[model samples]
Target chain A: MITVALPKGSLLKDTIRMLQGAGLDFSGFLDSSNRQLQIVESSGRAQGLLVRAQDVPVYVEYGQAQLGIVGYDVLYEKEPNVAQLADLGFGSCRFSVATKKDGPYRSALDLPPHCRVASKFVHSARRYFQSIDLPVEIIPLSGSVELGPITGMSEAIVDLVSTGRTLKENNLMELEVLFESTARLVAHPLSYRLNVDNLSEYVDLIRQQVLVVA
Target chain B: MITVALPKGSLLKDTIRMLQGAGLDFSGFLDSSNRQLQIVESSGRAQGLLVRAQDVPVYVEYGQAQLGIVGYDVLYEKEPNVAQLADLGFGSCRFSVATKKDGPYRSALDLPPHCRVASKFVHSARRYFQSIDLPVEIIPLSGSVELGPITGMSEAIVDLVSTGRTLKENNLMELEVLFESTARLVAHPLSYRLNVDNLSEYVDLIRQQVLVVA
Candidate 1:
């Protein structure tokens, strides 16, 4: 039997639904009260390991789970060793540069050199600044990165923006978008190469689901 | 009015209860229905900024909040510029090194050099390994460090151990404890030094409550 790692937050429901569409039964995890981190699908074809979105690639890379569904932002940030199977095109969002809405600066280049830029995605933020030849300090914050500018701890923040509702609520204004992000199917490279446990078959079905969504 | 940063999860209720003992009411945060990130105390003498546990120090360090309640592990890991006022003593836990219970290695020293050790508290782990003159590779994981060992991603994990229940459930055993962590009253250094917003009096009262708890 094959194992698949499913992220546990926003994209979980849709991911499980897509898998069900591909003939996998993971409805047990959809129950609100189900606290089980690992659940066997009713059909015994595969088991699902509910994990943090960021850890999805880690599981697949280590071969504990032959497949995983995670955000593209995470895939880019961690750069874990895994094969990108398909972009499911769900849970769409963008990685953005933002500042306090009232701030005088309106662009990434306007922020002063060595100024702080807080983000949970430190790697991605660092690369973005490096690509622009800007020298800004990237302060790593796990969550509530919006508070960076609010608290004056940083001049700006690089965080995921979806629906733009949260940025509006936090009094932040988007300056530049780093990239568009969407959930993608990822698989262990070796598992795919060797077609272990018919990994290719499941991946093809999931790929078809992605194309359907797109 | 003084601004305070209170963590928003498990320690929140107990922190508010302790503040009530000090005659400062932050019960608004205790109300599960309260969605406000920033809420004023009943007396209007202080306001609380509900934030992630790790971000509490950031708020305090930048003077967005003159006072904050957070775990010592965060203080040591982030190494923010804040004055450690008093140990709130609630929310006690420990920073520990662990591996799969059945692993051959029995201690930190037993793990081979260059072996991967995963942790969210990367700074603390690095310092601990350095102090011991070990040069192991430390992989930063945001959460679920236990999965590091189980999935063969890392040989061991350094993480917060609250009840040891979760670690036990994961089939991991603690090899060594780096330090015991507890919630602490941390203050913005300049705020306390200048006694801004009558910070001294409030800290003294909160300190008294800690004494009572002990």
Candidate 2:
């Protein structure tokens, strides 16, 4: 049986729909009453491991799951060794630098040297800062990064901005967008190369569905 | 105004109750309709910043919040530079090594050397294994770690066991416990040292309430 790692949050619904379009049904994960982390599809040809967005790549990389659906932001941050199969293209967002609306800094380069920037995506934040040749401290925060500026913990924050509502509500403004991110289908490198469990056929079906949606 | 960082999840209710006992009412956070991340108490003497359990210390460490409530397990893992004030004594649980119920391993030492152990508390896991002179690869997963052993990704998982319901439901058993943990009151070192915003008086009040309950 082919194991698919499905992310638990925002990307889940669309991911499941895409899989369904490809003749796989792991919709049991979407049931609020279903607390099972691992679920087998209706036909039992494939199983789904409902995991955190960050861990989706980990599962696929470790070969436990032959395929996974994850956000590009997570893949960029984690840099897990997995094959990029197809862009499912449903969840879309951007990694951007945000700061207090009334704060002095207007852009990434405007902040002073060694200014602290809080983020959950520390790896991406660090790389962005380094690319600009700016020296800054990236404080890793797990959640509610908008509080970073509100609480005066950092001069700015680097985080995923979906609707710009969160930033606006918190009195923060975007300084610069690092990149756009969308959900992507990924697979274990070895498994994909070996065509284990007819991996390519599943990938092809998912890709066709994505193309149909696009 | 004194800013207190309150954890968002499981610890929030009890922490709020404790604060209420100390004559501060930040129970606005408990109102399900309330979407505010930062809230001022009814009396306005203190305000609260609701954040993730792990980010509690970060808020306090940066002095954005002079005081915070977090789990001891988080403190043990993050090892942030903050003064541990008092044990709140609620939200108690233990960090333990667990494996599949039918697995060969019965204890931490029984597992083969270099076996992968998944955990959210990598710091504690590493320290525990190192102390026992056992070498294990610790896979850091963000959430749903029970899926680690279930998916054959790891030999064991080092996670917090509260009621043991999650483990039992997943057909896993505890191997060895690292330590017991409870909610703790923490303060920024500098804030506590300088007695900022009459911090000591508030700490004393909370400590008195803890003693009363104990």
Candidate 3:
């Protein structure tokens, strides 16, 4: 049996629908009140594990689930040892460097070296700053990176900007975007290599469906 | 005037009640639909900033908020430069080492050296293992640490357990508890030292109220 790790929250419906299109039924997850984290399909050919969006790769990496669907942003942050399969092209968002709307700095380069930049996406923020040869303190905030600028705890913030509304409501402006993010398919390397339970066939099915989605 | 950072979540109502008992009115925050992040008290002598439970200290450490109330677990993880004035004594929970109820090992010591462990509280996990001279790979999971053992991603997990329902539902058993956690009163070091905005007086008032509650 192939166990698939699916993320919770936005994009969940699409993922389930996509899988349904591939003939693997996990539609039970669509029920809002369903508390079951692990659900087995009626056919027992494949099972589903519902988990936090950030945890998709971890499950797949450990081979608990042969496959997972998660965001590119999570991929950048966790950097789990898993095979990146195909881009599913949904959950489109972008990473950006932002500062107080009234702040003097208009760009990432304008911030003084060693200035504090708060972000939950610390790894990605560090990589971006390092790539540009900018030395800045990356303060990791699990929630509300927007508060970093408002509280004067940091000069700027690096975080996912989904709708731009959260940033605008906080009186912050996007200074620079790091990258566009989309959901991608990932699988356990060993499982893929061993072709456990016709894993390659299911992978190919999803890949073709993803192309259809694009 | 003193700016206070109050955490949002399970203990928020109690924290506000405690503050009201100290004769500082911030009842506006009680409105379920209130959209304001920062609210000035009716008397204007104190203002409240509703922030993520984890970011409480960052605001205080940077002097944005003169004082903050946060979970002790967060204090242990962040270790921000702030004065731990008092323990408010509510929002009680525990940090524990847990695994699938049917797992082979019965205790933390029973786990093999360098065995994989997942946790949101990575620092505390590292410290606990190091103190006991047991080496383990601590994976930092942002959410749902219980999934660690279930998905076979790790041998064990370290996370907060409140009512233990979540763990029970997931069929995980607590192997060992590291420490009990409660909400704490904290202040910026300089603010407490310099008595900024008569911070010490308010701190003392709250401390007295806390003692009365005890």
Candidate 4:
């Protein structure tokens, strides 16, 4: 049986709906009472592994799951060896540099050299700074990058901004947009190339549905 | 005002209770309706920044928070440059190497060389395997590590086992215990040394109360 790795939060509902549209019913993962991480679809042709968004590519890269649904931000940060099959187009967001609204800085380049910028996406933040020829320390924080500016731990933060509400509520403003991100369909490179378990058939069906929705 | 970094999940309740015992009432953090990540006590002598357990040390080490509460597991993994002040003696758990119950390996040593082991605590796992003179590829996963062995992604998983319920339910068995962990009180080294905002006074009060409860 073919296996699909599904992200657990934020993107899960849309992912489940997309899978259903593709003739796979792994909706049991959406049930609050169903605690199982691995669930087989109604027809048992495909199974779903409910995992973290960051972990989606890992499962697919390791060949544990032939296909995965993950965010572009995670793929950019992790740089896992996986085939980019399709852009599912939901879960739109962006990586941006944010700082205290009342702080001196108005743009990414306005900050002084070596000023710390906290972020969960350290690699992406580093690359962005390097591309701009600016020197800044990227503090790797697992969660709540907005707190970096609020707590005075860092001069700025590089984080995903969804609605701008979180940054506004925390008295932070986006100084620069590094990149736009949306959920994408990914598959194991070898599996996709070899068409393991007729994976291309499922991939084609999912792609068709995603295109219709987009 | 003294700023204390309080962890957001699992340890928050006990940490708040401990602080209350020390005459700081920051229990507002526990109120589900309170959406604030940072809250001030009624008297406002101190404020709390609620953050992820791993980020607690980051806040404190950067001197944004003079004091913080976090799990020893995180400290062991991150190895942040903070002074471990006191063991709060709560949120007890252990790091263990676990594998499928029906798998051939019965112990960590039984696993083949260069076998894959998955964990959120990659540093701790690496240190353990090194100390044991074993070579294993440690896959760092952000969440739901129990799915590692279940999905055939890893030969074993190094994860915290509290009640062993998660592992048991997933048909895995703990083969070896790496270490025991509990909540710990930490302080910024410079802040503690300088006694900024009379930080020692609060630290002493909390330590004394923890001793009484322990």
- The candidate maximizing lDDT is 2
Measured against the true structure, the TM-scores of the candidates, in listed sequence, are 0.89, 0.98, 0.95, 0.98
Ranked by TM-score, the better of candidates 3 and 4 is 4
lDDT of 4 by residue, A1-214 (tens): 8899999899999999998999999889877899888988889788999999999998999999999999999999989999998999999998899999999988899999999999999999999999999999998898988888887789999999999999988889999999899999999999999999999999999999987996
lDDT of 3 by residue, B2-51 (tens): 99999989879889988888877777887989988889898889999888
> Candidate 4: what is its chain A TM-score?
0.98
Candidates in descending lDDT order = 2, 4, 3, 1
Higher DockQ: candidate 1 or 2?
2
lDDT of 1 by residue, A107-142 (tens): 999999999999999999999999999999998776
Checking candidate 3 for backbone clashes, the offending pairs are none
Chain A TM-scores, candidates in order:
0.98, 0.98, 0.97, 0.98
Candidate 2 per-residue lDDT over residues A1-214, each given as its tens digit = 9999999899999999999999999888888898888888889899999999999998998899999999999999989999998888899999899999999988889999998999999999999999999999998899999988887789999999999999989999999999999999999999999999999999999999988998
Q: Name the lDDT value of residue B45 in candidate 4.
A: 90
Better of 1 and 3 by DockQ: 3
lDDT of 3 by residue, A1-214 (tens): 9999999989799899888877888989998889888899988999999989887887888788999999999999889999999999888999999999998999999999999999998899999999999999998777877877876789999999999999999999999999999989899999999999999999999888988877
Better of 1 and 3 by lDDT: 3
* Per-residue lDDT of candidate 4, residues B27-60 (tens digit): 8888889988888888889999999999999888
* Cα lDDT of model 1 by residue, B107-208, tens digit: 889999889999888999999999999899887766777778866779999999999998998899999999999999999999999999889999899989
For model 4 the local lDDT of residue B118 reads: 97
Per-residue C-alpha lDDT of model 2 across residues B151-204, encoded as one tens digit per residue:
889999999999999999999999998899999999999999999989999999
